[model samples]
Every structure is written in C-alpha cells, then in structure tokens.
Target: MKRDPPPPPPQPFFFFWGPPTPRGRGGGGGGGEKKKNFFCFFFFFFFFFFFFIWKRRGPPPFFFFGARTRTPPSPPPAPAS
Candidate 1:
C-alpha cells in the first residue's frame, strides 16, 4: 500500500501569537506621569502665591509649627521738653 505524505512542520510561535508586546512601556504609565506633573505644578503655584502675598503683606501671624516669636514693638519715647 502507498504511504500518505507526512504532515507539515508546526509554524513558529510568533506566527500565531503575533509580535511581542512591549514590557512596562506605553499608555499605562501616562496616568502616573500626569499625576506627578499635576502635583509639581500645584506645589509651585502655591509656593509662588504665598511668596507674592508675603511680599505684599508681610509674614503671617502664625506658622504651621507655632505662633510668631517676635515681641510687640515698644511705644515711641516721650517727647523731650
């Protein structure tokens, strides 16, 4: 009896699976970048805002840690006769 032709060899893994996916790279990381940039922008904006107010007005009465340490100014000296 005649023998049947052997089956063809299996195809390469990539041929079925398609190109390999990039690892740890692409749109997934965009959110973190945006968050980081937002935080940075917020920090700088508040820093400059407070700095401007400080220049215009002066140091605030209190600080995060505690109240201001400066003592009240003494009254002006009495006028000489």
Candidate 2:
C-alpha cells in the first residue's frame, strides 16, 4: 500500500497576480490623515473667523461693566398749545 505519496507535502496557498496588501508602518492610515488635516483646517478656519469677527466688531458691550446704566428721565411734556 503506497501512502498516497504523503499528500504532496501540503503546499501553502499563494496568489501571484493579486495586488500586494499594505501592512504596518504608514499603511492604511490615509483616512486618519485626511481626518486630522480636515480637523486642523477646520479649527484654524474657525479660530481665524472668530478672531476676524472679534477684531472687526471690537470688544463686546458690558464686558467689564456688570449692568447697563440707566438713561436720564425725560422732562415732563410741555403744555399743548
């Protein structure tokens, strides 16, 4: 009885034509990079936008003062002619 030639020594599977998959070390991280760059740009734009608005508008009213001052009372209405 011949032992089926030892099952041809069990060769490992391999694909020669398929594209090589990236592994480790800066591989498959494009999405994260895009997200990071987008967030950075968004943060920068937001900061500058607010800063520009602030500079254009100057300091906010009542920033230091606690409450608004009262206006002087108007004089009584003059007698009707």
Candidate 3:
C-alpha cells in the first residue's frame, strides 16, 4: 500500500497521553547516542546543583524546618440546615 510521511511534532505541553504518556511513545526512544545525551543531562543537573551549594561554603541546605501549618486562609461557608 501507498504511504505518507509522518506528521510534524506538536508543541510541548502538559498531556496525560500520546507519545511519552498514556498512549505510549509514538516513535520508540532513540539510539545509543540519544541515550548518552539523556545521561549527560542528568549528570549536568547533579553536578551543577552540588557546585552551587559548594560555592556557598555557607550553611548547608536547611533540611529541617518546624511545622508550617496554621489556620486556613479563608473562613468556611455556613453549614447547610
């Protein structure tokens, strides 16, 4: 049978389906080089985060903080009869 070229990519946005989502990837993930690139991104994010904190040489991230909960910002409506 005859065939047509695939459609152009859509603009990125929040979607629960289609490629990389519920519908499953349209085109399967890439080759070795693409996988390498993805790992590279992970490495950069990790290193940059550590470097940013190291440069501070100041107080490390405050991992612990007391509870922040308080009264609701708005009053509830009157209860129905």
Best by lDDT: 1
Error of 2 at 51 (Å): 0.4
Tell me the TM-score of model 1.
Answer: 0.45
lDDT (CA) per prediction: 0.55, 0.50, 0.52
Q: Whole-model lDDT, candidate 1?
A: 0.55
- lDDT leaderboard ranking: 1, 3, 2
Candidate 1 has its poorest 10 consecutive residues by lDDT at: 21-30
- Give per-residue CA lDDT, model 3, range 13-73, as digits (tens): 4222234522233233313345456668989998888778878874354433523334467
Ranking by TM-score: 1, 2, 3
Which candidate should be chosen as best, given TM-score against the real structure? Answer: 1
Report the lDDT of model 1 for residue 16. 23
Residues 12-61, candidate 2: write the lDDT tens digits: 23222222223211223123345456668989998898788779996556
* Residue-level lDDT tens digits of model 1 in 1-81: 997555333334423232322321123322334545666899999999989988999776664545567578999999999
As for lDDT, the candidate ahead, 1 or 2, is: 1
Question: After best superposition, candidate 3 residue 74: deviation in angstroms?
Answer: 58
Backbone clash pairs for candidate 1 read none
